[model samples]
Target: MGAKERYILLLIIDSLIVTFSVFIGYYILAPFFLQYTMPVLITTSIILLISHHVFAYVFNLYHRAWEYASVRELMSIAQAVTASIITTYILNILLFQTTFTRLMIITWMMHLILIGGSRLSWRVARHHLIGKQSSDQEKLRTLIVGAGKGGSILIKQMLDTPAMNMLPVVAVDDDSTKQRMELAGGVRVEGKREDIEKLIKKYDIRKVVIAIPSLSKTELNEIYELSNHESVEVMIMPNIDDVMSGKVEVNALKKVEVEDLLGREPVKLDTAGIEEQVRDRTILVTGAGGSIGSEIVRQITKFQPREIVLLGHGENSIYTILEEMTGRNNNIEYIPIIADVQDRQRMFEVFETYKPNIVYHAAAHKHVPLMEYNPKEAVKNNIIGTKNTAEAACEYKTEKFVLISTDKAVNPPNVMGASKRVAEMVVQGLNQNCKETTLVAVRFGNVLGSRGSVIPKFRKQIEAGGPITVTDERMTRYFMTIPEASRLVIQAGAIAEGGEVFVLDMGEPVKIVNLARNMIKLSGYKEDEIGIKFSGVRPGEKLFEELLSEDEIHPNQVYTKIYRGKTVSYPIIEIEKTIKQLENNNNIKELLLDFVNRKEYTKN
Candidate 1:
């Protein structure tokens, strides 16, 4: 309601409360003690009620904003009552000569009781009875997070008018100062965040509503980890400013996403580092349709580079990303070149014509089992394709060249891994003498959902109502999400001393079978209902992957969560011989096994 209408309704309600309160007080006490006329006492009571009601209205007591209300409203209540009692005292002393009578005490009690009760009753009645859902069984048994301002407001909002079938069962806060405090509507503070484990178990709580909006990302990540463990669903209330601005309602709570849990301090790009290199300069990206490549395009475009060349083999994928890019950002000039990274002549022409100042080489034959069957293809694309690009960049004198490497490249047990390792060596090798171009290799582990990644496969399998597949119960690999991997790649490139191989610390390794089980549970299926199937290991696949070989260790870390590996420099003449043979021969069975460590490269 508007301010004026709300004031009118409140004034009428408080006046009715005072009037009834006087009658209840006089009906019980007036007959027993007072020798005054029964009609006189009531008439005096009615006069007192009118005076107090008017006083409340004049003080704007009835129109106090509930959200802004606190202890201040209670003081206003006391003032309004005292105002009426002083008038009563004056009239009794001067007009009626009724000094300290039992009826006066009774009326005083009624004034406090009825006035306070009227407001308090509305709070209680609205929260638990009238505002609550008729079918109380629909309630979700929710737990409010902080017992502070936001938390108290949320509890009141939930009690007064709950949405989505949620009941505020408990509230928690770490502030020892507020441990025993009670919010309105009888919602008491439970304990602290540390009490969640016991509280959830004791109350059978299924939902946790995080009302602390200004908490940092790291803290949110920690809380999310705690919530995900017991399979408790979590929702976070928006910031208070959003609520105040009417941009987001009290009801617009958001779900905890992976980024909320997994992200680091958002990378503060070295603007001088980027602008110094990218401004008014040409940039090229291979595999531009892929996850890392596309994100790099997005990031690079933000630098206002002279031109961004999106180079990829897949026409449809390029067109889709191009369409999305255009729709979101219209000012940047982008040229989508549909060409394979493996095609030397095409890449050479594109590079020479564009003379890209920065080249992000993300293209490679990456599927481990598929590369095992087609080792020759792995050699051509990963090793030779990298050679072509590196050579072309050197010829064109590109200032910075970043090669995206994989964690599997470390002591690789697969053709795909070995090919990437070889590609890194090629970059490091060329950097030895190439003064015009600075070639750098940044390696990371498996991304969560790149093209052909297991996340999509698991999702598809779950959708199909079939078993989720895992290679082996013991197989494990490191994981970082795609955007994370992409961002780190950019950061790694910007920091590289030429030929340096940068690796991200991917935390602890996760087992594949356990990963599948987690996915099944996250999808809301019981383990018995959606079974897990063992597919056996694929060719050249390992039970676990590594980020560094024993010999290539960096004792001191470079970035907080990333490391640099000791370069395993190859003899230049031997690399030259291998490249010569790689270019001439159609078959690369032995050299592939030798370099890629392909144990399953035997002829079919």
Candidate 2:
């Protein structure tokens, strides 16, 4: 309706209500009171009609759309009605020197009901009568998981806005108390989560919307696994806090991705302690362009450091990170240094120039097969580079040095893993000898979306509509997200005293084939649609990755989900001699393999 028409209609309806309420009130009270004669009652009714219309105009009741009325609108209605009757009572006394107190009270009560109910009835009629017709004809039946505040909000939105394309049919919650409870728009918490499949069949549900935003990753995976039994589409709601804060709308739901299933619970850290160490301190991060190193840079920026020195071998990757950090954190200082970790002299030069208070050594040759082919580069980058950085840290009296080690370093089979194992020894040895600098190593498994991780490879293959390659059906690896890994790395530095090798608790080892299958499904394809190829394991690749070797005992929990791996006594001079011998040896690959095998052999 047009604005003029709506205003006119509301004005006329309110006038009739006021007139009727006053007339009925006077009729009932006329027989009891002789002062309230028929003429006097008629005159009083006329005065009330005029006074009510004046108050309603002053309160702007006609300007509002009653169909969308809420508490604020109802309060306005009460105010206008009260003001009209109060004004009538005063005027009747002033003119006739008499008052009909009982008559006015009855009229006031009647005015409230007739006016408030009329406005509320429009919303009720639309939701129950009109909305049900549209929902039944056009909307898809949606089953909502989680019958909490988030689910209630989603149900109201769906009912109020049919253009959202789905109507909530039923809700499921794990809390038994909530069962048999009804939510907004008549959506009921019919049963528990285990009954989801049955409810889907019973209601002929086409879509399932998970409305719990605060669900832990572990619980989310369990719920999704159960919900995926049917061929219906599944969507997940974004964080409720974000929605409430207006960062996103309540209807902003997205398809559950592969990362959601494989991810673990978010790691909580001591931000105050981290800030005390990093704030106002000059920090240097080697390999600042690589996946893990770059994320470390980003995470450290949150600590508000005095300066962040981005030292990397590649100019382009370094430039990319520098640009991103510049745009995101313009208040902090970022110094981009293009230098390789293998250059011992250059490493000392960068350390002396920056004089960084804390150092995060992340540069290393991490590709297993490629490092297996080129063992010399692995030794140069992983072992010697670590030695140079560790020794430089000690010389410059850097407060703490954190080396990023991997799970492959445990019972090492590949040159890359062996190199990292020796690097850990280098850091521990330096920490043992030097009292000024506290050196520690953090060991974790493959990060989910790192530069050369299998996640991106599987995604590419799925996007190309071809066979997705898996090394072996039985091969398994522990996975953590990049942010989680980087946070734990910083946590290690926070918890380190000296010479401690920290191991992160990677929840479970996921089978490689299962990872591939999930990626295919997330990409909107079935197993048969995208063929799975069993590519034989590559050289230096293990059937399963280990977080810690058998001899490395975890004697302490430094923080939750983080443990301290006991440092083995290895002579610093012996480790130095091995590095020198590696440079001169013609059979470098054999020596590297033996170096790692001897460590495991000693463990036995």
Candidate 3:
């Protein structure tokens, strides 16, 4: 109903209740109606009606959404009725010269019951009507994984919103105290997380939602494994911030992603240190169009930099990130430069023109197998590109230059890994020669969801229906999210003391075959349905990837999830000579590997 119509309806209903309560009190108190004059009774009824509405207006009883009434609404109704009764009792003393204290108390009791019941009935009726209508529509039977506040809110939202087409049949919580307890919408906590499979079958659950916001990645992985049924689609509640801010409804559950099962807590950045260094500083990020590069650019913008120079070879990628950054923040200057890092003159010109305070060199040839086929391209991009960028930064006297290295750089096996190792050497060597700039390298493992990563490839193969290919059944690689990788890169810049090789703790190496199986399950498919094919190990690929070499290992962390490696310093002349010889060498891959693996370069 319209607000005016609702208000008018409540006003009329309240008038009748007020009038009836006064006369009913009189009738009950006086056995013979003749004890009170008709005029006195009529005057008492008028006084009660006027006083009730005045108090109702004061309490905003008419403005409340009665269809969702609760204890608060009942309290408002009681206050309004009690105030009106007290006012009527005072008027009876002045006009009739006799206060009807007994009658006033009886009337007050009647008013509370009638007004409060009327508001509550609306809520009950609406729920019943919604429930009856929901029975006619097809709804997915869902199982909630947590019986906490989040789960209760989700259940209530699903019940109230029948259009959502989700019927929360039962909830499962690991808390023993909450076992067999009922939550909002009368959904019972049937069992614990381990009983997910059994409860799904028992309830005929078609969907499962993990509603625990504070659940650790390890616990989430466990719950997901138990709920991984082919027929039952699993989803998770949105982040707590998104729900509390009203950005999305409590019932808006998102699909469970493979990233959620990584079982590693995100590395917390030293925000104060990062902000002190990056805030209002001119920051330059090369390869800003690629996955990790773009993410680095995004994270840097949060610190409110004075200017950001997005330098990349690809125009489209640079333009995409530029548009996104511009839309989000107009105060910070976003300058997109379309130039290759390998172009030495252009790099120098760009650096000299911008004179960025900090430089993040992210442009590199990262694909292992692809780099193996074209080793020359890997050298030109990863090694020479990093050299050109680092030299430009040193020449321009940049405050800090961070080289985005990889785990592949540690005891490298592939051309890509070897090239990145050379790139790291280039920066460490430059750090010694240039005292004005603090140069460092941050090495991490495979970034999930990056271009040509396993996760995206697996998703595509699953979408095509069956036969997800694994390079090798025994192969393992450390994995981290792009944002996590990027944030650590920025954090490394904050903690960089010249020439330190900062190694990110990738937690543990995940077996490729197990990762494939999990992806298939997350996509709502069985192992048999999405058949896994062994492609065997490709050229330049290793059975496992490492974050740091034995010589570089540091037992203690300099920061949370960040380790500063004891790296060997190479003569800048020898590193430059290797870069010069690789341009025309027929055996570039062998030469590159030999240069990086030399034991003599170790600082002893």
Worst 10 residues of 3 by lDDT: 29-38
Q: Please give each candidate's TM-score.
A: 0.74, 0.82, 0.87
Cα RMSD, model 3 = 3.6
Steric clashes per prediction: 0, 0, 0
RMSD of 1: 8.5
The candidates, ranked best first by lDDT, are: 3, 2, 1
Expressed as tens digits, the lDDT of each residue in 28-89 for candidate 2 is 77687656766777778889889988988888888886665778999998999999999999
Ranking by TM-score: 3, 2, 1
| Best TM-score among the predictions, by candidate number | 3
Q: How would you encode candidate 1's per-residue C-alpha lDDT over 517-586 as one tens digit per residue?
A: 7666556566777799999999888888888876678877786566888765555456667767866776
Write one digit per residue (lDDT tens) for candidate 3, span 484-505. 8899889988988899999988
Better of 1 and 2 by lDDT: 2
Candidate 2 local Cα displacement, residue 110, angstroms: 6.9
Per-candidate Cα lDDT values, in order, are 0.76, 0.87, 0.89
Candidate 1 clashing pairs, residues 3+ apart or interchain? none
